[model samples]
Target: MDDATVTAPAPDEDIDLAYDVFARSCPSRHTLEHVTGRWGALTLGALSENTLRFNELRRRVDGVSEKMLSQTLHALERDGLVHREDRQTNPPRVEYRLTPLGESVAERLLSLIELIEGKMPEVLAAQHRYDGRRPA
Candidate 1:
């Protein structure tokens, strides 16, 4: 073995993104779609801690496109999960805080995420066994 070689644990961010959907998409599924969006869960999680400006939110939730972020926020706002407040100032200041319903949803989502995190190792092992190939 090369003594100079070193291996640190790989980032778990990618693997942590599996449970990002509900059932099949349909025209009637408006609110659930908004609540279960790509950035929605993370956005809710961030806002659960405290109010944040749009830029701050973007920075906190990694790997989100600007357009997608705006869309997600707007959808949540329309559905009442998020509260968007705009300040009438020179540069324009905006802040997002969760609504009461949003807080409840955030709590549930966080708990679900925690459960997934705890079982992820076992889930991956089962997946490998079912597929007959060890994880790389």
Candidate 2:
């Protein structure tokens, strides 16, 4: 099928959408994975604050290898979540920033990150309890 149109019942109404993320074949799943993956999430979060060049972004993301960051940037750029600007300068300068859609995604992702960070104490306690039950 060229597109998948599914009718989902909402709390107040019936909604018709062209794509369903829950469906296995939906393209949104890949996009979601890219946005939520460790490196991708960190990259988006870092860019959420400022536009950065390659090395600067690499440094900001901390542990990401050069190749991985390059690949991540390329994927995000292809997904329309990132904008890459190439400037004709003495040595040439390239910078990456979020597109409008990316800003929206990053804003939501940051909220999720903040929530996870804030709940770490409780999460750690739960982890301790769970691990206590495991065999040595």
Candidate 3:
């Protein structure tokens, strides 16, 4: 099946999509996953604040293994959400920052993060209640 010719989930109207994240076979789903995965989300959030080197990003995200961070950055870079710049100095200097599209995505993601943080008390209470009801 040609994903580019696939129709989106419009109830009453037919809309052909080049790529629909909702479609199971759509390539957009992979990009969406890359942007929203644990390490990917953290890395994007950190870079949204300032451009960073590889080590700096890993430090900012915390708890991410070196291999995981490397993989996450590569995926983000490939998705055009992260821009990597390498400067040719005596010792090579590399930096990572959000692209324009990445900035937009990060802005939305930060809003979600803020909402989650603000609702943590409620979330914790819910978790406690849920745990109390569950058998260990």
Candidate 4:
């Protein structure tokens, strides 16, 4: 990921995308924010496969608060990583999908997911070792 970026959100100023995560402040931080947030990465990864309604998204992603999910969607939408569509239908149909940019990030995240899953046992062991309890 030579091109990943990072940055802090400023309420009133234009974001200066570092365009490099290692940069002091990557302008692409917005995308990273979406990918690593409580509901962001999951949402983007889920949507990468196909579009889904709010409920569907909720079902696919576990352990996310409604408020957090909503916030994540809004942020991703603002950053152009996600697309929100409101349709005229019974109770109104709203679906979330990822933009091409988000898809790129999702592809990267997929590998990350694999890496994390592969190392889960080791991670848990490490955590347990430092969890303040003696090892059995």
lDDT of 2 by residue, 65-103 (tens): 999999999989988999999999989999999999999
- Order of all candidates by lDDT, from best down to worst? 2, 3, 4, 1
Tens digit of per-residue lDDT, candidate 4, span 1-136: 3533433567688775435655544555556766787588888889988999988898899988788889889998988789999999988999999888888878998899889999999999999888868656
TM-score of 4: 0.74
**Model 1: per-residue lDDT, tens digit, 1-136?**
2223233335664443222223343322476767767688889889999899988999999998889899999989987899999989989999999999899889999998889899999999998798886455
Which residue pairs overlap in candidate 2's backbone? none
Residue-level error in angstroms, candidate 4, position 100: 1.1
Candidate 2 lDDT trough over 10 residues, lowest sum: 1-10
RMSD per prediction, one decimal?
Answer: 17.1, 6.1, 5.6, 6.2
- Residue 54 of model 4 has an lDDT of 89
Best by lDDT: 2
Candidate 4: C-alpha lDDT: 0.82
* Candidate 2 residue-wise lDDT at 74: 90
lDDT on C-alpha atoms for all candidate structures: 0.81, 0.91, 0.90, 0.82
Candidate 1 structure, TM-score to reference: 0.72
Q: Give the TM-score of candidate 2.
A: 0.87
For all predicted structures, in order, the TM-scores are 0.72, 0.87, 0.86, 0.74
Alpha carbon lDDT at 102, candidate 2: 98
